[model samples]
Target: MDVAEYTPQELARLQLGFIIREQPQQNADHSGTHASSRKRELQRGQQKARQEMLDDLGVEA
Candidate 1:
């Protein structure tokens, strides 16, 4: 086995992530819990980003 087989791009992918449709379907119930959680996370991130922009503009959150 060679320790020098890794490249920067390959290492980045190892730290990266992606959604698998099958796994969520198999694991989560039919209530779409995983999706709702992801959506909530996304919304929170967006809200935080928007708040940052508003703060920069001296606007109220």
Candidate 2:
């Protein structure tokens, strides 16, 4: 748990691999309509962001 022990590259690798997901309770829509849409949207956003980061790092995904 001591991040200080990790080098910058190691820390960045860990950070980039971490994903924060939204809880079902976070969305008031229990009907599975808006929530699914939002989830897909968020996933696409994450994928785009990750691709951008990988591109910047010159790493192939």
Candidate 3:
């Protein structure tokens, strides 16, 4: 199914999946700076997806 067919919960689940998939590997000894940057990126993506989902559902801020 297309994105337009997905419910808000489904959209959220998909966004969560994306964030999880994008997470840095546990075995990697990345510095705090890199880790924080990656985390910020994922958070931004989640926020954007949530906003889009809310918009699709005709929800107001």
Candidate 4:
């Protein structure tokens, strides 16, 4: 049987195990990556958000 056929209990167990194994390796950055990298990321996110809002309002940025 495929792993996707696993029962809910089994799937939950697998997910919990994966999180436990990976959590410690996860990034703890308040921003993300290095300082310069984070600035670009924030800028991109802000620009995207503004564009989305403008699109909803039928306006161009």
Best by TM-score: 2
Provide the RMSD of all predictions against the true structure, rounded to 1 decimal.
9.8, 5.0, 5.0, 12.4
TM-score ranking, high to low? 2, 3, 1, 4
Worst 10 residues of 2 by lDDT: 15-24
lDDT of residue 46 for candidate 1? 53
Superposed model 2: Cα runs more than 4 Å off: 1-20, 27-29
Looking at model 2, residue 40 earns an lDDT score of 73
Error of 3 at 28 (Å): 11
| Sort order, lDDT high to low | 3, 2, 4, 1
- Highest lDDT model number: 3
**Candidate 2 — what's its lDDT?**
0.65
After superposing candidate 3, which stretches have Cα over 4 Å from the reference? 1-31
Q: Report the C-alpha lDDT of model 2 over 3-49, residue by residue, as the tens digit.
A: 79997766655554443244455665574777778677766766776
Model 1 alpha-carbon drift over 4 Å, by segment: 1-31
**Which pairs of residues clash in candidate 2, taking residues 3 or more apart in a chain or in different chains?**
none
lDDT of each: 0.55, 0.65, 0.74, 0.59
Clash list (residue pairs), candidate 3: none
Q: Residue 58 of model 2: what lDDT?
A: 100
Q: Where does candidate 4 stray beyond 4 Å? A: 1-33
